[model samples]
Target: MTGKLGIGIITYNRKDILQTTISSIFRHTKTPFEFVVADDGSSDGTPDLLKQLNVPHVTGRNKGISWNRNRVLWYLKEEKGCDWILILEDDCFPSTFGWELPWIEALERYGHVNYMPEITIEIDNDITSGSGTAEDPFIAPMHQAFCVGYHAKALSYVGYLDVRFEKYGEEHVEHTQRFLRAGYGGLSQYLSPERGQLFYLRGGLDTLPSHSHGNPEIAQRNQAIHNSIRHEPLYRHPWRTDEQMFEFREEIATALTRPPVEPPSDPQLFNSIISLGGDGIVNRAIKDNFHWAGLGLFDQFLVPFHTLTAFLQHNFAGLLSTTCLYGYHDALRCRDTLTIYHNCLDKPAHVHASVEMFHEQLPALQYRFRSMIQEMDELCHKTQRVLFIRSWRDGLYYKGQHRPDHSATPDFRALTDAIAARYPELDFRIMFVNFGNAYVDDPRMIFANTRTPDDSTAEEELAGWKDLFSKHRITLLQNR
Candidate 1:
């Protein structure tokens, strides 16, 4: 009770109802705590409503309920450093005075608790016959997820909502089950009607906009996924694949400690080097593999890997779009020459093995090959030069010649050419550097085919790569 409590209202496309919910919570709830309405990319004036209400909140692209809930958990618990968190759906509004105390108390006593509806059930007489106050609340084993509360201890053990539950349905069920399996007291009816205190009620005063329509197919699919994983150990966070999970965890760990690497200020213009390739460029810089001998090339990167990865992790829905490679950045922050680099390795082996696989899952690959077109056009007034590296061959991995003609990604040549023609002063150039082995042979783009270090050691090869990059930087400077 001494520690701070954070309340989060998960909402999507329900501006009017959310407004009512916020107003109701303010009026009824007596707990002294800061709150946030975690907006799941609401377009129906929800952001405007949050602004008008002056409520602190976070917004991201409309990933499903699970991801939205995870956002709240991450922000309130991890970022805001709250000791206790109470999460409620947009429709669930407080019905009782000092409704927050019991929830917070429940989180303290029982690691987790859920809001039970007023519907009567065959309750255990022994447990139901308690005082039912903040210290002793009427309890039940049944789990209802419309409203839920957790202490930091519970969250650390329970992890997060299973993201595999795409839309709705079984996500909360799976979460509660996981919590129970972790040797903790799971969901309980803290606001039992038998105790004469109803904590909260669902739905707003007026008709609300619906975003998550009940898809029978999705429900069935989610149910199946849930059933399959029911007997398994505590569910992992975020990703399904081990590789992806490890990759995400490592990236998150890096983001936690790594501050945004700032670029040296250009007095006249804002220049940034963005990597369209995955972590390759960042890894090079971090390991001191890249040559920054005298050029200070490392300081020119405005959008480093850690920064971009953190943004993408939060706004994951952007990954589904084939056009948007990068996350949202302030347009004011970017100007002048914007160099974007992408290698063939940007497309992961298992994900983008073929055009069929690439289209099906739409795996979260690094490069959105056509994003530069939009960037170039948008920054035309400020941008004077565009050095777009479509392909760069390193000796680390074998290059695959999956051209734009064969895949869903657009032709970089056609896109850049159009951009160049539209803005003659843009000085757009696409370079394909095939240093180790030449896999892609495209005439429209500039190709730098250099000798492969076939017999060199790892250290020697790394040094060679550093020198190669230095030469490229020299060329880039001359072009500028």
Candidate 2:
């Protein structure tokens, strides 16, 4: 008993590409549904084209992707009183013949359906299509609202997509999680073609929004939003008891069981202890973070930070910090803001903001601790993990004329002890890896303080890690 159906195609200045998309729907679509177009302030004669085509369209004041999509949903559900609606991006297209009815029938069968085109196969470049069975289609744990169909009844609980995602990205995954938390996630099946089959235009992401050419602040904002939604499940009704959180986690885990996100591994991957380096490295770099997530699991258990400034300040007695914009510099000089793994992402505005925010922390200020601490807090908030690894020689310090004594165990021990005093609650394991000669035969030598004289013996080096992790209730596992 499907009521009046509404099909919306959202566009934002991609008029050239969108023309083919609209034509394809008319060519292949057999379902009796109203075609509604929502334009997000397109300037390339898109509105005029829609008018000439006699398509019922609405104009927006350059809102954004989420706002434009929601506008279409609002009209279909609220204004037109449609029972079901399908929203397609201006770039998406049908690859196979008569692919529309199956998706429409899916809405009739279940309350909602997320149409997963065969793009994943091409993306992965896999051996086979791996186009899963109907009963066991690839159950996506994360949602990308590329193209989707929704039953109107599910809307009563799921509400509308969050408008906070003003630009591209983050909106799809968040909305999908919303449906899951609200219990409508189960009423959906994914539709995907066989491997090597693409149900889309030749070039999708390459055309719009300067794909990946974005400000670093956007990355930070996106990550922050993701953390909030993941940490706080805004279920229509909260879970009865704290115990129910486990049920939720288990349910989500079960939903994610198909198409394993992690590569094929041991069935008991979670139970096993994992480590990537020598005992000394693991000892100095592991931490058992007790912060709990919304789902009640340990927030972050192990994290490591091996950097030039961290090692000099925490392992050696050397003070480390960037030469202030208006401050004096002695023998050793370093960029106060040591940004790693970032290039054009850090816009000038954000970099300047951070520059102004830098302030004095310790009295002598051997190294900048505030920014690093903020970074650690963010990492802990995200992974429930923190860094304990300190490289004896990092890039900036290594480039200098002088190098610190690599075998200064007493100095290392004292600094590590002071760090422990500062963070008494961190169930800490630490290591200092010497990267003085990174490219030579010994790329990174593992450094251990003299708790035991024999550094060569595996038994002596890894003496207390078992007990330390045991106390913290962590089963350390090694992956790489």
Candidate 3:
């Protein structure tokens, strides 16, 4: 626990974002640690940029995500002897300065610190102040590997990530269950009250290969995930004190004995990413987690997000949108009533709201529909491809020769990439079906030659979607 912390980034192709991630780490993290990048054969300028930054990096020959992560662990843990390594995707960055101290401190107390949080946290100078528990800190319980810090001692027992998980998908959850089996727990039970802990960053990894949703390979990929958690051998911690060992064992027993909760089938994508532990330790730790799961991907994102924007617009007038996430669950738990002081200079100013007033204003959520326009509730459950509906030469959503690289707007990349960074298993493709004239050369967003019968009516919009679904054989679920 007293050893150095190494921030490990798994990256490919994105040069600019990687640099920003590195710069943010140096700027925001007050802790002394090694900055290492594990590159999966980036022909981009990333390797050169790393060299310029004077950071040590390992070059990979197109090995998949799982292998790269394990290799990074081997290099950092076996060769460098760091006590802990925080695995961050290349697109992630620290939202504030010295934000890692609390994370490191949490690792000291807990065996693991899983960071799949969507709500942005801002940590002030005090690293000890937190609301999470050693078992269930921040009262937020989400299972999956978005970004996580692991103690070397814990890694020794759990071993490297299962390398068979070639792309980002379920490896983290599989790895997490194994870690639990190895007698480790997340920092849910040890959050401090003194430190400010809001951090945010865009993800840097792709989720899935293009248009690979409902592909048989996904089911096969998930089998490996099942194997990782099924019966992985457990090992006693070499460094844990007797008291820690007892608590760890208790958590494992809870996980094993409790019933597992099955993820919903709507997103079909959720089935791949969410492992069902029937009311197991994870299910029981925090009740809000079920509420979270019910949020069901992107559509669920709208509610809390809209409220935050509305609050920001009304109270903190200047800021319209932010990478920062407000206390989302708190607002809901308070029955739509949220209170953030607009005039606080350094910290959150205290305030209260009436349930009636908050509800009266909450209905305005419908006006901000542009963000969700043409957006699906979920992208065909692990769909890495986007089959856009546009006219061939109509000048609607696209303009010019229809090629992906010519697409000038890979705007979908940011949307899908953000989700992919958090879920790495979801490889996405943004395809623009050229009902209009637009070029699509970017493999990430390919152009297809499909068009709707008419663009002038909602009937046409419905027909267009139906045609696309029929062509791809996709089933659309009702949006919540």
Best of the candidates, TM-score: 1
Instruction: Report the lDDT tens digits of candidate 2 across residue range 383-407.
Output: 3223344433223212221123232
Cα deviation of 166, candidate 1, in Å = 1.4
Which has the higher TM-score value, candidate number 2 or candidate number 3?
Answer: 2
Please estimate how well model 2 matches the true structure, expressed as its whole-model Cα lDDT: 0.46
| Candidate 2 global TM-score | 0.42
* Model 3 CA RMSD to the hidden true structure, in angstroms: 26.3
Per-residue error (Å), model 1, residue 147: 1.1
What's the ranking of the predictions by TM-score, best on top? 1, 2, 3
Off by over 4 Å in 1: 119-136, 186-212, 239-480
TM-score head-to-head 1 vs 3, winner: 1
Q: How much lDDT does candidate 3 score?
A: 0.46
C-alpha lDDT values of all predictions: 0.52, 0.46, 0.46
Clashes of 1: 0
Error of 3 at 173 (Å): 1.1
Kindly list the per-residue Cα lDDT of model 3 for residues 363-405, writing each as its tens digit. Answer: 3433332333213324434444322222222221222212222
Q: In model 2, where do residues sit more than 4 Å from their true spots?
A: 125-136, 186-216, 229-480
